[model samples]
Target: MNYPLIVFRGLNLLVVLLCASLALGAGKPLTDFSLEELMAMEVTTQAKTPQRLSQTPAAVFVITADDIRRSGAVTIPDVLRMVPGMHVAHIDGNKWAVSARGFNGRFANKLLVLIDGRSVYTPTFSGVYWDIQDTLMEDIERIEVIRGPGGSLWGANAVNGIVNIITKSARDTQGGLATARAGNLERGSGALRYGGKTGDNFYWRGFVKYFDRTRHHGLPGETAEGDWDSLRGGFRSDWYPAAGEQFTLQGEAHQTRAGALRTEPLFTAPFARLNDEPTETDGGFLLARRSWETDDSTRYRLQAYVDHFQRRRNLLDEDERRTTLDLDFQHEFAPNALLDITWGLGYRVSRDAIDSGQVITYRPSKKTDHLLSAFAQAELPLVAERLTLYAGAKAEHFESVGLEVQPSLRLLWTPSTRHSLWLSASRAVRTPSRTEEDALIVLSVRPFDPPLPLTSAGNTNIATEKVTAFELGYRGLLNDRVSLDLATFFNFYDDLRNFEGVPAAFVLPPPLPPLDALFTTRNSETKARSHGLEAALSWQAHERLRLMGAYSYILLHVEPRLGEEDFDFSEEKTPRHQASLRAWLDLPHNLELNTWLRYVDALERGPVPSYLELDTKLAWAVRDNLSFALVGRNLLDSRHQEFPVESFLKNSVTEVRRQIFAEAIWKF
Candidate 1:
């Protein structure tokens, strides 16, 4: 393929379109807000409270609804690529490896994810199943991404970052919407949604969505087997029960059948071979929340949710069912004119039942775990509105890890309304997952005559992984038409996860071969330190054109404590440099054009070579509530690899291919 020529031609076409649009000046601009208005936007994920972006003492980025629609991203993971410090890579057609800063993998455990205040991080594997996390993209209000530790408020597993997906209120989406899309890679997809009002105070909405994705190219001539389809339906309702009180109820259910190619070792003659398998998953959740404000300027909220899921995987011969129940309460008050305080309490219980497989087994097939936590933060104004100080901590108790405490201190200095500077230091931890403490896995087997097997045994005495991070940031409006955000961080890690070699043992059966080597999962003497810089710039080039650019550089170093071996692969997993540029232009005849160009550095371990790609979208609005769009993704190349196959799962490596799709949306 003539990759360079294709990219050149694409860019030329984009330029030609821009020229025509400028000459005609016909379409409405996507964003009419000024840089100051953008800087003054309020975000909640940073502190669990509303704070202006320019004054918040954290590294935060928000993706608005307009950004989502213009990015031509079909999935949440693809939309996240715009964040400066975030690393998003596709493992296959149905799987992705996403992380922040460093330590990227199939199951990146350090980053925490939430959907409408409900956590989606699974306790079974300490990671998310990206294939099943879905919703109607049009209904998403915004995605708030915190690029630093949120442990002081959100609790464990939030060591690196937090991603919160917030949806729009039912009242904002009153009407009926229908959408359909088709393409070579996407296959087919459609959505139907309706919103109505029962009374003056009550609003409700319901929606159903379905999608089928085709498989991607495999390594060279091999056929990659990952293809998936999903169906989901959900509803949300909001009621203003009284003058000072409000209530919200929402629920969703989903079913998915995903295909994959797995390689596993057998106890018999042929050590390992390929296995074509399909994974079946079904899940649902219901959540309710209530909020009230008192005349004395005090606020209170209560929320609860129940979630359940079941999965069947043939490659591991495992069938699993899990359920979780969580409850939380929060209060906010200003004791005095100079000081404000926020506090919360939470409880969660999770239970899982697993049927063991030939390759993997859990000591206790059925187990239950509980977590209790409380957190409080106080904000003190030092120099009126110019300087402020914030301190907070969270204490959590669990059966396995006893008690864990995370604390943070932050200071923000606003020199002017247009610029602010901030610094923070925090501590966070990651608790052990069920698989790390109870499962025994057959990592691989040597093709010897006797068939020597290498196994990984779980250790019950594993400790929590911990990190202490320091960060400094600046957010400012460079001018009336431009804005800039910069952040730098240094992190130190301790008690990191590692595998230690154990003595080999023989099997009881006489004909069976002995275990060649064994390793146990544990918190070894491995330590690490990382530093990075991230910057983002936004320019409203004209009333009809907007441009955004981002760049990030990171360096991670790992070493053994004293004379111990590292025995970890954290250093080579993350890329060293990443950059992206995006442009949105309004054209004549109600036309819109958006383009994104991105580059990712290679991973040292897989030697996955660096690659650059482009995605473009062109849309035409026929009326106020009807539109059509043509989207092209990965136009620079036919296919390219983004990540290597996971070592533990041994899934087949696949490449991302060029895709073109057309979409039509109608609202009545």
Candidate 2:
């Protein structure tokens, strides 16, 4: 009985069997689809136009591509591993510290990652360093995970979530595809892609990749273990000389080398100061969109972009460059009384360069930054088949918060066909980075004048990081195999830019010195609360087997107002308990079988004593472009440790113990 009284009596028997199937009218909520398949699965980035997920109201989560190839995972943060208030970890091997809903670790500055819509963050650590975040996971095609506060439509770091990553056009990838893999720990890999057609309004695609990874051992004898190698290339094209107008071209380039291991002790003292270091980064973007459709509902779009970014690393002596020019436009009015409308305007400019080791910075003497924004959204349509009301607002002007207004209000209700309800109220922000506007501390540990040197410097007038979010959501399916997506949030913080510790009382006339108490970056007054519950299930029982699962339970509190330092271990590193079981077996000569079983839970730090991880997958297909695979990770080897300020360990490392891999694919 308990268990929240069986979840409030199973949500009151699912709202009384969906109101007795809408009093038997039986056709509602896309009754069995149609309206052109519900406008091809209604979705307009959560309220720009058409919306459906039983009638949208944020808290969305979709990662299709067959759930990223059935979660065997090949990046994209391992397919965002079953979303649901995501917080995927894995801090090494190209680093990763994704977050959503709560302050998560490793520079997870309020989340807001996009691709294809371009904007990979990292304008000097804004977020996302997911180890050179590679793309081309089969050219994506889905991955829109929004979890609370999109700031009236993506503004100011989206405040905790927004990971769009849409792609898959080259006329829908018209040709070649290939992949090969090997492992003992992901030791080798390969990929190639090809697409055609370049006349009658161009369309093209090209991709090439190379990879090497084998370096992660560290534990005995303590030798550096940071091996990595990478090479990447990219291309995308599209041109529609007529018909609604569209033009897009994209580019990417990469180079990486690492063996990195050095933590100042003496220029040369062999034990673990390895190096083979060479680092590089490249970027390119060009966008132009023009849309005009005076009928069938109306449309308008005008977008522009130009980008060039570069990064050079030498362990720590930065050389960064960024040049950006972006502009935006969008307009869709009419669909009248549903208030269907969307608005837009945007601008951006950036430039950065820094070079000075041992932590040092020289204020951004104005590389450049300018962003003016405007946004509007409406959807109000209540009672024409249930209820819905969405509102929006966005007004930004920053060269330093000259103006700011991010608003949101949403509410959706469906009184039939499998009830659903949602509500939201938001105001999100999280700006000021360069580690809180240029953090510089050049040299320390040179007290006697040998190992450490000067020290202390940082403060570029830091300020900009605010939030006020509130949301509530619920989804339903309760039958024909179950389904549920629930949400809850309450985040209220201000300024909040950590790193503070100031104490100094000096008098150095005795030898050659004085006070030395410093730890800059400040802006406090914080708060947090991210309630949760996300459930997913699909039990076809038999009929080719199926039993999917996903569970999330979050309850972060973070509120220590008197003498800080309480960000709560982010509640034991994600995965409150994730379960999985999938099958599609149809074994009979021609062949076709797929399998998966996963369970991840148990994790801790602070008294450190918790662990558990297991994964599995198997596949065999002889059609639909062939397939063959086998992959296993941890498989219960269990040992765990993924960042706890592990900083090149003295212990608290090793997250994978047993791994097996193999893969092959082809498509034409």
Instruction: lDDT for model 2, please.
Output: 0.62
lDDT of 1 by residue, 305-420 (tens): 99998989833758889999999999999998888899999999999999877677788889999999999999999998899999999999999999999999999999898889
TM-score of 1: 0.95
Model 1 root-mean-square deviation: 2.6
How many residue pairs clash in model 1? 0
Error at 505, model 2, angstroms: 24
lDDT of each: 0.87, 0.62
Tens-digit lDDT track for model 2 on 381-487?
77776887878888888875578888988888888756578888888887776645654443333334223233334456666677787777777666655556677
Clashes within 3 Å, all models in order: 0, 4
